[model samples]
Target: MSTILVTGGTGTLGRLVTERLRAGGHEVRVLSRHAQPYAVDLRAGGPGLDAAVAGVDTIVHCASAPRGDEQAAAHLVAAARKAGVPHLLYISIVGVDAVPLGYYRSKLAVEKLVGESGLGWTIVRATQFHDLVVRLLDGLSKVPVLLLPAGVSDQPVEVSEVADRLVELAVGAPAGRVEDMGGPEVRTFPSLARAYLRATGKRRPLVGVRLAGKAYRGMRAGGHLTPEHAVGKGTFEEYLARRF
Candidate 1:
């Protein structure tokens, strides 16, 4: 068993990764700002970071900024290098290269950092999580008619599946950039929202609005969904059943 350090242990994805690593009989350490079982902060360069990663053989870097903060990725890569961590696994989003979304741009920058860092690394790009879809549906339900960006498609993967994949990457040898992982099927926002509403027994009408711009055009072209390699098993309907 190897000692693995997870950068975003408190988050939705990080929490699951940490649990999986622990369950696999690996020594797990978490990096976070707040004090917990293990505490370290990449942004502030906390002292605990070095100690937390001292003997760690692998680092699962799940911490990321909201698209606009590209500098954070550079810092994280540098920190991992300085810590002398042998392996670094970064979890990234799909369509980062095809779409010009701010968040995707940041993720792309991070992927570049990991590639150039010369550290043993595996960069796994995945589709939007099922939780993101659930959150969007819940937030849009407050409006009388749910307004969704038309023509945009997404293949949402389960967070648990992504977490499992991250663990697999952590334990394996670094493959600079791995294949994209996506859901079983590609789906549109309005259709997904309606399906989720019907599954949850909520009566909300969905209004599809075609957005005009580069972002909308990119999404309409199915830039976000992976076409070639999709390894996840859960479908949108299964995710809805479990969530609602």
Candidate 2:
């Protein structure tokens, strides 16, 4: 069996990836800050990173934060190069190039670093996860009125579907910048918020406000959506029904 090291193995996507890999009878190592023995913070770059990446066949990089993602990717790349890791697969958002947000820019930078790292690499850009959309609605539901951005739409995919795809890519040979993964449907924020309210049995008025920003404009223009690549099976309504 091949040995696979999953960075951010304890996270939402990483945990699922680790489980799937282990279930397939592969030797899986979970590398996270709290994971014993391989507890290395990628953003800080340490000796533990070198140890974690050594002799692994593939690395499913799912660790990410709002900030410092570029630093984390650089450290991980350096460690992977030193360990002679053959394959490095990264998970990125769909609109990193189109969106003008700071986090999206960081993700795009990481993508470039991986592509030019002189190692066999693959990058999969998927739409936002259903969980993130739920979290956004949750935060906006704190009051009687739910404020959402006008004209902004998202194709939220299932996290498990993304993890499954990542596992498949991890086992296969590196194919740079493969087909994008998108959800089954493109939905507006207000519509999704309504779905959440219906599933949770909460009553709230959704108000869509027009925002002036490049990022908002990008989102409104459907930069974050991939209608042609709607390969994911799960729907947001299904997720809401199951979750609630």
Candidate 3:
């Protein structure tokens, strides 16, 4: 069995990927910021990354931050190339190229770095996760009125399903920039917020506020949606029921 290294192995998606890979009998190495033996920070030039990547056949890169993903990818790519790693798979967001947000731009830049890193690579883009939507609603519910962005819709997928796909890709041959993944249904913020309220039994006045910005406009225009590839099975309601 091949040994695989998983970056961000402790995160929502990466954790599941690591678990699945191990369950499949593949030796898995988890690289994270705080985990021992491989606790290398990817953002700060990734010191001690070489040891974590050494002898690894494939690297599943899921570690990312809002600010320094490009730098992190740069360091990881350099390390992977140095270690002569064969396959490097990345998990990205849908519409990263179309979205004008700073975070999305950073993610797109990382994707470019991964593609041109002179290594066997696969890039898979997924829509927002259900956890993210719940976090948004949870934050919005803090105040008496739930103020959500007007005209913004989301297709949130289950993180576990995404993890499954990533693991399958990691174990297989490199397929560059494969099909995007999305949730089963496209939903609006207010609509999902209603679902949240229903599941959590929280009653509050819901209001939609139209925000002005290129990022917000991009989100409102459905740049982050993948209705054609709506392949995820779990629904937001189902996630909510399980979450709460």
Candidate 4:
């Protein structure tokens, strides 16, 4: 069996990826700050990380930092190259090329570095996670009035489904920038907010904030969505229901 390294093993997507790889009878090593197993700082690669990459068949890079995506990817790529690692799989957000947000920009930078790293790799751009969408509204709910960008929609994918796909990619050969993964359906934020309000029993006035920037323009034009590639099964409604 091949040995696979899962970075961000404690995070939502990474945890599931670790479990799936182990379930498939493959040896799994988790990269985390905490003391579970295979703990190493991907942001700062050293001997521990060097040894981790040594003899590793594949690395499912699920770790991400908003301000340091490129640095972490560069470290992994260098170490993986030095150790003769066969493959590196990276998870990225959908619409990174189209979105103007700083986080997305960093993710895109990482994507470019991986492609040019000359290592066998696969880059999968997935839609926003259901948990993240819920948490976004949760943070906005703290305010008396929730302001949302008008005409922008969110397609929330199941984190577990994305994990399954990542495992599938890891076990197989590297296919460069495979098809994008998205939710079963795309829904507006207002509907999601109303659902959140109903789910949490909170009362707040909803305000639609109009936008006129490239970010909003891209979102409005559906630059981030791939309806033809929408393959996730779990719906956002079910995701919310499971939380209660």
C-alpha TM-score for every candidate: 0.94, 0.99, 0.98, 0.96
Candidate order by TM-score, highest to lowest?
A: 2, 3, 4, 1
Q: For model 2, which pairs clash? A: none
Model 4 — TM-score against the truth?
0.96
Displacement of the residue 193 alpha carbon in candidate 4, Å = 0.9
Displacement of the residue 59 alpha carbon in candidate 3, Å: 0.3
Give lDDT: candidate 1, residue 219: 88
Relative to the true structure, how large is the alpha-carbon lDDT of every model? 0.82, 0.94, 0.94, 0.90
Top candidate by TM-score: 2
Q: Candidates 1 and 4: which is better by TM-score?
A: 4
Q: Compare candidates 1 and 2 on lDDT and give the better one.
A: 2
Candidate 2 lDDT at 46 equals 86
Per-residue lDDT of model 3, residues 1-244, tens digit only? 8999999999988999999999999999999989888999887755489999999989999998878899889999999999999999999999898779999999999999999999999999999999999988889899999998999899999999999999999999999999999999999888899999999999999898989888988898999999999999999999998999
Q: Summarize candidate 1's per-residue lDDT along 49-72 as a digit string, tens digits.
A: 667777789989888656434565
Q: Which residue runs of candidate 1 sit more than 4 Å off their true CA positions?
A: 67-69
Off by over 4 Å in 4: none
Question: Alpha-carbon error at 7 in model 4, in Å?
Answer: 0.7
Cα RMSD to native, each candidate?
A: 1.6, 0.7, 0.9, 1.2
The top-ranked prediction according to lDDT is: 2
Candidate 4 lDDT over residue span 67-186, tens digit each:
777888899999999998889999999999998888888999999999998899999999999999889999998989988888888899999999999999999998999999999998
| Best-first order by lDDT | 2, 3, 4, 1
